[model samples]
Target: MKEGNGLQIPAGMRDLLPGVACDQRQLESRCTGLFTSWGYQEVITPTLEYLDAITIDTGEEIRDHLFQLFDRQGKILALRPEMTTPIARVVATRLRGAALPLRLCYAANVFRYEEPQAGRQREIAQAGVEMIGAATPLADAEVIALAVEAIKQSGLEDFQISLGQIEIFNGLMEELPLTVEQKSKVRTLVAKKDFVSLEELLNSYGITGAPADRILQLPTLHGGAEVLEQAAWLGVNDRARQGLENLRQVYQALASFGVSDFVALDLGVLRGFDYYTGIVFEGYTVGLGFPICGGGRYDNLLGQLGYPCPATGFALGLDRILLALARTNPPARATSAVYLIGGDDTAAMLNKATQLRSQGLSVEIDVLGRDEASLQAYAQTRGITQVQYCRQGG
Candidate 1:
């Protein structure tokens, strides 16, 4: 007796039942506490925005990934694919006059139209922080430290923060004599980790020298601090050379914060987002394939929005972090419920349930007129370890 479509949820989306929902809420609460303690205030942005607002040069690859629709007013809108652009718009327009180094945090669901995978979903929850109006290296360092601490607070023990400088690639691009079409091809190859294609492309352009070799090495260049020294020998142009120096200064600033142990340098980490102007980083756990969190400095993005402020922040994928932590440390079992049975004592059960709820206890009553045996079976299936009996006399 079902409808035409049958009862089923859509693909790349899911319902979080009681057990998973409870665990997720606990994780969100823990993260909220951590953010509040760090003096970052929480803010909420609309889940949907004008399509053009969220899609500006977000990258050609991601444009098709957004879930778009037409509003009642005949305007194109999209469920936000990411939080950064909306937050940037907020800072640019509404909070433009707020103090420097504004720290704002949020936990919300973001939508994307994409093929579903084991742990990735089209609709996902993200908890992130944005610090606007600060362009100092110390601001970047603080964001990195905060990301590490949030992961640690989530019960993750083994993890690494891979750091990179966008300027590295920008520097190389500035020095390249290739045409725009060739530059696009190089960016695509670099992003895909297609070193063979990169070498082929370089050879096709008839470019040969230490600079080409160094640029070719970009994809494989990542490790500890010493890799920075090796990068220096790559024979970059003066602009690229200055960019390298900027990276060195940022790395030293991170070291001064005492978070050097958790950081790794990766000169090849040209994050996919086209907006990032400088430092970029992603957090990874050993068992996970994708980064649990990522962010970067976008000094020019605000200017695009008309305010022209420098900002940097990171977004923690709440669902992915929950999954990673669940693998490492499974969430504790939910508490037992107090079940009230029998329709005869409905009034008494209602009063008792309300009282228990006030006392911060999970309480349920049988309204289906089932027998005690059936009610017991239901409780067992729900993982209610204990049940309290309430009677009219008692």
Candidate 2:
């Protein structure tokens, strides 16, 4: 890249100008408001942390995406590629003894070093909530319900939260007659949804009958509630069945909580983070090709940080959400009612402006030296609600 590129920022980063910034804040506010109402307080973690601390539970894929550097003292450091890890660190160290079932939320920017593409950014804005110390299906249901409500509140329609349980997969892998390496390979293939490759893999392993059939069946087992029933009878093992039952309870509870219409069961829904020991899910809409929101149960994450507690949470990407909203219901330009008065009438304008501001109205004194007719035209063009002439000496 040339130095003459006119104040160029690195690739995968862009500025959020006025209009989009307004929408971004509105989106963040709505999410944080919903979190606050649910008693989840917000936390802001630093953008940089000791590299090892950030990479504790996140897998190699996530670590590879981190932008790493060395500090003056030669200690390795990284810009946080995701927000949850930072939050988990704090919960384990700082808020460990604060309380049981800590409810926390944050709207913050995260950085990554990855090839930029649609719905992806090097610097992304995220609004998320994490509930710590709660370990039950209801806690899972709470986060999922909040997620649905958040999308609904954002004015997004036709989005679905595909819920899956890592325990089901874990249980099945434990029962499979495959090598340790083979099990990891199966997980990778299934997560990618590469059925052909998965089939080839199973065939190569000399696996047949129900084990092979069930493995292939997973990536496509998404639909109405019946899928849960089908999962319950997959015959994998006691552990898998127990996990499926737990998932079923959470799904049904979400229905009773009134957000079922926006959720579906998908056995193949695997989140990349290995810390997720139980249910996981991602939110998707019609037009956008990526999940706008995602999260799951990470019962072991805090323990790795020396804060042993069960937790669940999810994060919505503000930029992708804005894109989804734009594709679906493109927001109208944000507007406020304002009356612009002409000329320099500081005393009177100040008094009037003060009164209008006090009343929660937008008022502006003409600083452009625009004449009465020109001022009226300017106000009209700018959608100023009213226009008046404030003679200079009056």
Candidate 3:
């Protein structure tokens, strides 16, 4: 292997220049503000947590994706693969004594060791919220509705939320005669929407009849409220029926919130996490093959952390959202920047810059002492429009 220059970043990471950085910051601001307006106080968790703590209920896949390191005491510390687990830990310990249904939000970066591609990265910047101690369809609906609004607030209008209840699938599985390994394989196939393989696997087990039929029909059971009616006609078990009813209540609540237009009933939807006990959803926008945001009701995660409370939340991939926006509406290169070109009087330039900053303007003073031509050239290259000269006397 040949050694290269030091300018190269890791494969999964890239440098975000000024304009892109601005866009990311703006997106974060808009989302955090919306979260605050919805009465969700911002919470910050450490970037790294104990490997055991982070891997609480996360399955083998997520555990394998963790970027782990050993600390001084030889304890394994891993960069958090996601925020929900850490927030659950926080609720279990710090916020344990706090009020019920804690509405907390966060905007931070997470790490996961993966074969990075377009949306999936080694370092992911995300923002999301968690509502602790609430275990109702209304709570699920609330989070789903908020996710819709958050995506809209990010200037993404052409998006849809695929909503599903894991219990529906669990309910269907309850009636099936299969070993634990078989069930795990079925879940993997369903999550992948690999109907062909799923059918073959089920047929090999001699699992026929209504339950098998429903399992096969799960992925196709997506669309409007009528999908629910179709699922009901499938003669599902008690648990499946309960999940359908829960989906109905959530749909009604979303309608009440005026966000039902963005939601669709997806009975086959299953999140990757093992903690989801009820509603799970993923948000997709036009032009993006993968979901830009996802989360669900994890009524059991807090219990795993010893908190024992029902919680629900979602996280939006800031990078993916920006990518979607860029595809739809490319950010303008030109920025509203005012460059204060100073002559001999650096103090006057500083004072003017301060004054403009006080008036909420993005002002920059010429620290390099560039001449008029050079300053204008630099400003033009940087997409800076406004340029003012600060002389010695002024």
Global lDDT scores for all candidate models: 0.82, 0.87, 0.87
TM-score of 1: 0.90
Give the poorly placed runs of model 3, Cα more than 4 Å off: 1-6
Please provide, for model 2 over 203-290, each residue's C-alpha lDDT reduced to its tens digit, 9 standing for 90 to 100.
Answer: 9999878888888888988987899777765747877888888888899889889988889899898888878989999999998878
**Total clashes, candidate 2?**
0
Clashes of 1: 0
Residues 45-86, model 1: lDDT tens digits: 999999888876577767889888998999999999899999
lDDT of 3 by residue, 169-240 (tens): 898888888997788789889888999999999999998877788888888888998998888855467877
Residue 337, candidate 1: alpha-carbon lDDT: 63
Q: Which prediction has more favorable lDDT, 1 or 3?
A: 3
Q: Please give each candidate's TM-score.
A: 0.90, 0.94, 0.95
In Å, residue 213's CA in model 1 sits off its true spot by: 1.0
Ranking by TM-score, best first? 3, 2, 1
